[model samples]
Target: MTQKYRNYDPEFKLYVVKLMELDGHKMTDLSQKLDIPYGNLKRWKTEYRDQKKKEEKEAQNQLLTASEYKEMYEKEKKSNVELQEEVDILKKAMHIFNQEK
Candidate 1:
């Protein structure tokens, strides 16, 4: 006779890992209680930890340093001032043209 294999969804795996973390349950205890293999539970926990570390590293890489943020702010402010000056000049030209008409 052949034994059937059971498949678990991602939510179930995450819930099992969280249970172990929040309840301070041992791998053997959870495996017996949940009817899952001990090795599978251990592997899921390891994979979850590695994934979190990778995400944190990516987030750190995407953040700008203080000097970079200041430089970007200055550039945007200068561009905005230039645009306002152009608008003021156009309004003055329109006023002069209207008076001469």
Candidate 2:
């Protein structure tokens, strides 16, 4: 006779890990209560922590540093001033041409 093992989905596995975290439950206690193997619960917790760290690293990568943001703002301000100066010059030239005509 062969024993059948049940497969748990990712969401369920995450939930199980969270239960231990949120409730401060011991792994052995949770394992017995949930009827899951202790080793499986331990592995799930490890994987969840690793995944969260990876996600946090990725998020950090997507964020600009303070210096970077300041530099970008300065560049944009300079570009805006240059554009306004060009517009002013064009307006003066247009006025001068209209007066001559």
- For 1-101, candidate 2 gives per-residue lDDT tens digits of 99768899999998999988787889999898989999899999999999999999999999999999999999999999999999999999999999997
TM-score of 1: 0.67
lDDT of 2 at 65: 91
Model 2 regions lying over 4 Å from their true place: 74-101
Per-model TM against the reference: 0.67, 0.64
Model 2 poorest 10 in a row by lDDT = 16-25
- Each model's lDDT comes to 0.93, 0.94
lDDT of 1 by residue, 1-101 (tens): 99878899999999998888777889999999989999899999998889889999999999999999999999999999999999999999999999998
CA deviation > 4 Å runs, candidate 1: 75-101
If candidate 2 were superposed on the true structure by all CA atoms, what would the RMSD be?
5.5
Best prediction by TM-score: 1
Candidate 1 residue 11 C-alpha distance from true site, Å: 0.4
